[model samples]
Target: MEFVERYNGSGLLIEVEKILYEFKGVQHIQIFQTKSFGKMLVLDGKIQLTEKDESFYHEMLVHPAMLMHENPEKVLVIGGGDGGAVREVLKHDPKEVVMVEIDENVVKACKEYIGIDRGALEDPRVKVLFEDGLEFVKSCKDKFDVIIVDGTDPNPISQALISSEFYRDCAKICDYFVTQSQSPFAQPDYFKSIYKNARFKNKAVYLGFVPTYPHGLWSYLIASDRREIVLDLNVIKERFENRKIETVYYTPEVHISAFALPRWIVNLIS
Candidate 1:
């Protein structure tokens, strides 16, 4: 019956029906009901996702790299405990999806209160592993067609994932790797670190809108040493039509346009 607010600079406040779950383990985690956004998930006092516009973030994070490849059969998802990233990956009908999440509590809380995941975690094609993502990437022997990192911001806990060491290992194992790179406008320096530290031969950054996150705009990076990810617009469009997937935000045009960086981002990354 009260409102919880996320304190950044100006911050965001949401009226909650009730706090469904809240705990302090490794980090603080909470899930609560909201009227406009449906249910919301918070991690370490940061708003992770709200039910209303999560599709924008999830679709953009998943589809661009996925379509960049011809047929991505084997995929890896790291740290998206809410399962939104996993759900998007399922649309392509990949042979297998290996998900490694650092926090099991986040998954459990999202599973119970927030249904944004739309039940993709239980899909037979997915294998869920609760472990440290950086360690998992270092040790994984299997090569994947695509690797998507849906982790938190680059803090001490997530710094290793955005580190050059992790990026090198990921490049060696996967044909393509994509990860959240923070908002281009809000955390430009941090975003630059994550985007630049990858050091891959062929890397590209894309932009999307995530209303619940800081600045209402977010950026993501796709990195690979295999070859340039650029494909013809027609080819991307054909893939979209052939897959017959229903998406809320990302389309072939949007996929092509995501790489059309804003001038500010162009300057930031340059």
Candidate 2:
């Protein structure tokens, strides 16, 4: 059986599948059927982004801040080339949504193939910039109400995005900073380093879990200059209950439940 797709100019490959329907949407984007990870979206057709259970990743990234802030207007998203993060951020109806995605191909593929992003690119309020996120943060003079760092794993290329310096830069440009820290179960050292770095730069540091990612669980770190790290569970629940938008995964109950970490896991961080 062929394991690779015919190469397309935009970095996409088409693959013939037996058990799973595999297709390369772009140079870095591969979609496949999987038993555990669900329909997986692989970058460079290599790293997995989502499975069938995508709501877990999307909800954990977006709702915590949406509920935490009284009202968020200017929102900045870094490295969310797939647009899943942007889709969730838009629920708040922010005045401006700026996405700094280093790879324009990822955004193009996601818009053309990924159903989850659901036309987030077409929103008039969104401004897409094809540039390095780290540089964008460094040069940004205006601060944002919320900044979500939806970056990939810490390979050499992504190392700067997860470094202490990056978090410091983010602190300067954002009121609230939320990022997908490496999964504690898979890359505890990486997560610890980022957590410690974030704690050193920002006042509030908190963690949340998403279940769809590798190890059937994932972690995210939240840092803010002024606000406490805890999500207002009551407020989030109320917002979900009153929400007019159709949602697949996030609810008031799920919002509160995701934050409930096991004592062992909490102790590991402490």
Off by over 4 Å in 1: 1-8
Q: Which candidate is the best by TM-score?
A: 1
- Error at 103, model 2, angstroms: 0.9
What is candidate 1's TM-score against the reference? 0.96
Q: How accurate is candidate 2 locally (lDDT)?
A: 0.70
RMSD of each: 1.5, 5.9
- Model 1 whole-model lDDT (C-alpha atoms): 0.87
In candidate 1, list every pair of residues with a backbone clash: none
Q: Give the TM-score of candidate 2.
A: 0.82
lDDT of each: 0.87, 0.70
Question: What digit string (tens of lDDT, one per residue) describes model 2 on residues 26-143?
Answer: 2445555544544556664344455455766777777777667767899999988888889899888889999998878777766655657788867999999988888988888988
